[model samples]
Target: MYVYDEFDRAFLAERVAEFRDQVARRLSGALSEDEFKPLRLMNGVYLQLHAYMLRVAIPYGTLSSDQLRRLAYVARTYDRGYGHFTTRQNIQFNWIKLEDLPDAMAALAEVGVHGIQTSGNCIRNVTTDQWAGATPQEFDDPRIWAEILRQYSTLHPEFTYLPRKFKIAITAAPKDRAATKVHDVGLRLHRNEAGELGFEVLVGGGLGRTPFVGKSVRAFLPARHLLSYIEAIMRVYNQYGRRDNIYKARIKILVHEIGAEAFAKAVEAEWEAIRDGALHLSDEIIADIRSRFLYPDFQPRADQPAALATALEDPAFAAWHRNSVHPHKVPGHAIVTVSLKAIGAPPGDATADQMEVVAALADDFGWREIRVGHEQNLCLPNVAQEDLPAIWRRLEAAGLATPNVNHISDIIACPGLDYCALANARAIPVAQEIAKRFADLERSRTIGRLHVNISGCINACGHHHVGHIGILGVEKNGQEFYQITLGGRADEHAQLGTLLGPAVSYEQVPGLIEDVVDTYIELRAGPDELFIDTVARLGVEPFKERVYAAH
Candidate 1:
């Protein structure tokens, strides 16, 4: 984790003080709601349908146990007894009082966390593979560049207010766990033929009303010229991106309007003038940033064959071991995902007590570190294999051990009309209904490796565009309805899903989904064939026919 230096501390203190003053003025009637909107947004505060919502950034989704405890404290003291982890790997408190926001910001600052740049048209939190440092297949820790980009983008005067909000994601692994194809700017770190490290830069990828997979603008951008190249891209977008229409304001829209080749040429022309300027990163600075991310001392341990034997005996443990535990680079260790998608609960939400329990478990068994995945699950990245049973027991007792990672029950849903002002229908209840519909562990296992994402609206905050089964909520004739899509994926071979059929009523959503799953099962060649592979093989026509016919 990157520790805050004196400059970092001082900068955050100044931001807090400024926001405090702004809030005081608003309360004193010196500022109207309209006048204070941008100010509150800049600080990651939003007035939602019911109450104020505060989003706190968790850079690269890394947190210390102490930091986790601090978040729990905030949930317990300031708002409701729970917080929602978002698809962006950030957390949102949905019930904050307007007057207590500054105090909340101060509390977060005490633990080296902040909500800066979490909202309002600038680059948001730079995310990477949650298993960055621990994964064996990665070329290097992607967080190295994520941190560098965060530092460079934070409060950059030229980019403080863009035509629209921008997002950047980085990954060094062969797998696209970071969903690189769906970001405003996606950087894939790779080695060239000469064995020199560089980046494969992609631009224009985004999901909203108009979804697009980013195009590769540069086959290879030198590692040293990252900042310069990014600046060039920003300059191009800032100058020509749509400003009159909010829907087309994103860089993705600009890239789509202009050809990718022309966009690439424009960026290259801008880069040529500034590639060797002060923005170029030096080798020394890169090394210094790399040094700050020291890995924990992993002691050699023998594999626990007894735990494997126990898995054979207990079907519950076996299911958990298969789904929750991931392979680790270190011997006799594993990465455990604490599923927030327990049956009938809102996806990605954790109570204050649950947060405290996770913190304690991390301190005791996970080297005092915790990670949040873009899937909205908590990860103990370095748990020893021998300790799996005890950890599973503890998590199960706390209702955190659902063992449904990448399965039908592990849904990803947004706050929707339940909390978000931009939403058309309630998303959380839809997700909860679906989870409850597939509550049988054996049934979910049979369904196998499915991602069901629901977004309340076209904002795509829930990333519905990329799920294997994407459910989008819309309003028709003053009633809530859902439009379904199939075959979307966010992996190495990313593609946007195609619409399945006409919008169905909220009452028909769960049954429609069940029909889709049943169609996949009937058409699949074998049990090993995933829902996505089946969809790809047979296309959406088969599933669409069954869903609509059943309804």
Candidate 2:
């Protein structure tokens, strides 16, 4: 966690004051709805279908106990008693009143959290692996670089308003937990043949009405020149990215229009001119950034805790451990992922009390650190293995311990017609029905490591394009219909899904998903093969045939 300095505090205060004045003017009729749109968007406020929504940025999904508590307070006081954690690892309060926004902003600023750059065509929250510093297989912590990039790009004069919103993701691990390939700019930190660290940069990756897996622009960008190289890419996009149509404004569209090779050539030419400019990251600056990040203190202990063996005797504890617990860099320490997707509840929402419970657990057992994963989950990145049983019990009591991390029931769904004004249909109820359909833990585990993502429209806020099973809601002839896609995944080998067939009625979606799962089971080599692998091995034909036939 990077603590805010005097300058950071001062900047947040000024922004809050400015926004307060803006809101007052809007209420006083000095600014109309159209006039206040951009100003409110710049402050991360959106006028949704029902009311105003405020999205707060959780940089790289990292938060301290104090910050978490402050978020809990904001949720309790300003809006409803809960907040939705989004796919981009940010939190949104759906019921926020426009008049109370300045108070909320000032309260969040006290803990170094704000919603700036969370909306309007600018660089959004920079995200990375939630387990960045604690994971064993990473080359180095990516959050250090994520924080550096955040400071460099926040309110940058040149990129304040791009043709469209841009996103950047970085990961140091070979296993891409950050969904790097589907971002506007994705960076993977890897060592070259000569053992020098550098980035493998991917440009033009995005999902929306048009989906694309990014193309590799630079096979090796030295770590020292990260900012300069990214600046070059931004310059190229700013210069040529379309502004005429909102649908074609994204950098992904620009890269698609001109070939990727041509885009790379243009970026390289820009890089050649500015690669050694003041934007270059120096050793001292990198070190300073690294030093600001808080790290856990690990103690020597047994590889496997003795109590863990006893805890496994309890089937509930065993299930949670198998699904939610992940390996950590330090021995006798584990990373605990808390699933917010409980049974039929809205995915990624945490009640104010639940937030406090997680914060309390982090303070007591997790070295006072918490992380929000892009999967709509919370993580205690450094929990002692011996304390696993106690943590599980606590989580269970709080309704935060759903042992379906990667299973079928752990769905990713956007706030469709329930919240968003742009949505054509409701997504939350669709996700809820599917979750209820697969509520049996044993049956879900049998289905195995499946991702089900739903979006109300083509905006793709739920990341429906990259799920193993994607559901897109559409309005056809005054009726709600859902389109299904298969075999998409967001990882090192990222690819967009293939549509199975024409859209089906909303009532047919759950049964359709069940038919697809049953088809995978019948066609899979064995229980060892995942749904995604089976879909990859056999194309979408088998599942598509079964699903349509069943329908």
Candidate 3:
């Protein structure tokens, strides 16, 4: 968890005050929507279809108990009774009133959270591997560097009003849980042959209208010069990143226009000019940041074979183990996912009550910390196997014990045209509808591993372009339409999804998905065949024949 400094706290408070006045002016008719639009967006407030949508930043996707509770409070008091968690790990309250936004920001500030820099064409929140410290494969905790850079990039004067929004993702782990390749700037931490740690920097990687995996610019950037090195890249981007055309502004476009090697040379020249300056990390700062993120002590113990078998036999615990738990680095301890998806419930929606329960559970069970995943789930990273039964009951009561993690119905979705002005269709209801369609536990489990990513629009906030069954919503004569894609994966083996055929009517989606999944079941080589693998082997022809042949 990133601790807020005095400057950080004061800065949030001041920003809140400024936004409060702006909101007041808008209400008093001194400012019109035209005048207040940019100001509201700067504070992560956007006017949506039916109401105001507030996007709160969960930096590096880490949250404290206090912050979670405050988020819950905001959900209950200012907006609806629940908040929607996004694939990017940020939470959005769908029905906020603009007048209450400043008060909301003030409440978030009290807990060291804010919505600043979450929207608009600026450096957005830095997202990392959800299993940052806990995952075994990680070489170094990327959250440490994410926090360091979060502070450095917050409201940077030089690049706040760029041509379009900017995003950066970092991962120390080799498994690529952060989806590093699909970011504006992707950083992978590795050690050179000489045992010196540095980053393999990739620039100009993003997914939107144009999807391009980031390419390597600097193969090795030493650890100590992280901030300076990143500064150099940003300086290069700030100078050359297109400001003329909104569609062609991201660094990926620049990289494509001039090529990766050319971009690398420019960044190197920029690094030579301003490195080792005020932006560079000092030894003390690095130590301070690193200490804050140090892993908690773990007790070495072997699992009791007899007792373990007994627990796994229990129905509730069996479901949880099957769905929500992962093997911990420590023996006998398991990383538990408190599923935010309940049948008929919104995919990542959690009530304030649920938030408090999760927070208390983190302190009591997970060593006082919680992690928000890119898939919109929360993980308690240090639960002993023994404590899982009690957790299941508590989570069951809180309505967060849904036993779907990466299963067929554990879908990722965006706040579509329902709550986002930029969106073209309604995504939340579709996700909810799909969950309801496959509400049967045995059916979803039988279908096996499937990733269904939904985006309300082509803006691609939902990452629909990269789902095993990707669905993009389009406007057809003013009615909602959806296009499906097969074979997308967001992993070390990252591959973009391919379009199946023409757009399907919105009403035809759930049945279409069911047909595709049913086809996978009928045509599978065995139960071991995943949805993506089946698509890869047989190609889209099989699924497409089943889908569009009837249409």
Candidate 4:
């Protein structure tokens, strides 16, 4: 967690003051809805179906105990006693009143969090691996560069109003937990053949009406040249990216129109012009940023043996340990994922009390730090293995200990017609229905590593494009119908899913999904073969045939 410096605090104060004035003007009728649209959007406020939705950025998905408490307070006092964690590693308060937004902003600023650049057609939140510093296989902490990009892109005059919204993600681990391949710009930190740390840059990766796995623009870029190289990419996009149609405005469209080679050439020409500019980070600046991300004090202990012993005796704890707990870089420590996907609950909704409970747990056992995963789960990143049982008990009491990480029940779904104005059908209920269908923990585990993602529309906010089994809500004739996709994955071998078949009525979704799952189970070589691996091996035809057979 990078603490805000004086410059950062001062900047936030001024920005909040400016937003407060704007919000007051809008409420007082000094500015009409048309006039206030962009202004409110710049502050991460959206006029949703029923009320205003305030999206607060959790930069790179990191949160301190104090910040988590403040968020819980916001959920308690301002909105409906809960907030929805989103796929972009942000949180949304759906019942925000137009007038109370400034107060909410002030409270967020008090905790060094804000909603700036969260909603606009500008550089949005810079995200990275949730286990950035703690992942053992990482080349370096990708958050260092993610934070650097945040500082550089925030309110940058050159990129404040891009042709369309841009998203950037970085990942240092060999496994792409950050979904880097589906971002506008993806940076993979790696050691080159020369054993020097640098980046493998990918551009034009995005999902919407058009989905693309971004192309490799730079095979290797030196670490020090990150900012300058990114600037070059932005310059190319800003100058040539379409402005006539919103559909064609994203950098991905530009890259698609002009081939990847030409796009890379354009970026290279721009990079050559500004390679030695002020944006290049010096050794001292890089070291200072790296120093801010100090590793937590981890005690040396032999607790894993005890943990294993406990797991052997208790099936309940064993199930949780198997699904929710992840290996940490430090021995005798683990990363415990606090699942938000309890049965019948909206995928990412966490009540204020639950948030507080998580905050307290983090304070007591997790180095007072928390992380929001891209899968809409909270993580206690530095929990000692010796303390897993105690932490699991508390989380279990709080209803946060759902042992369904990567299970079929651990679904990712967006606030569809329930909250989002752009949605066509209900996503939450579909997710809820499916979750209840697979609520049997034993059954879900037996199914093995199935990811179900739902989005109300083509915006793909739920990241449905990358799920092993993706459900997309759409309007067909006058009825709500759901479309399914298979084999999509967001990892080192990222690929968009193939559509299974025709859209099925909402009532048919759960059964249809079961059919697909049954097909996978029957076709799979063994129980150990994941749904994705089975789909990859057999292709989508078998699943599609079974899902559409009755229809």
**Per-residue C-alpha lDDT of model 4 across residues 340-414, encoded as one tens digit per residue:** 999999999999999999999988998889999889999998988888888988999999998988899899999
lDDT of each: 0.92, 0.93, 0.85, 0.91
| Candidate 4 to truth, TM | 0.98
Give the candidate order by descending lDDT: 2, 1, 4, 3
**Lowest-sum lDDT 10-residue window in model 1:** 303-312
Candidate 3 wrong stretches, greater than 4 Å: 294-297, 300-309
For candidate 2, lDDT tens digit of each residue in 1-551?
Answer: 67678999999999999999999999999999999999999989999999999999999999998999999999999989999999999999999898999999999998888999999999999999999889999999999889989999999999999999999999999999999999999999999999988999999899999999999999999999999999999999999999999999999999999989999999999999999999888899999898887777678978777899999999999999999999988999999999999999999999999999999999999989899999999999999999999999999999999999999989999999999999988899988999999999989988889999999999999999999999999999889998999999998999999999999998999999999999999999999999999999999998877789877
Q: What are the clashing pairs of model 2? A: none
Comparing 1 with 4 on lDDT, the higher-scoring candidate is: 1
lDDT of 4: 0.91
The runs of at least 3 residues in candidate 1 whose Cα sits more than 4 Å from the true structure, single-residue gaps closed, are 305-312
**Residue 167 of model 3, lDDT score:** 89
RMSD of each: 1.1, 0.8, 1.9, 1.1
TM-score of each: 0.98, 0.99, 0.95, 0.98
Q: Give, for candidate 3, the lowest lDDT window spanning 10 residues.
A: 300-309
How high a TM-score does candidate 1 get? 0.98
lDDT of 3 by residue, 57-159 (tens): 9999888877888898998889878898887789989898877888888999998899999899889999998887777777888899898888788888987
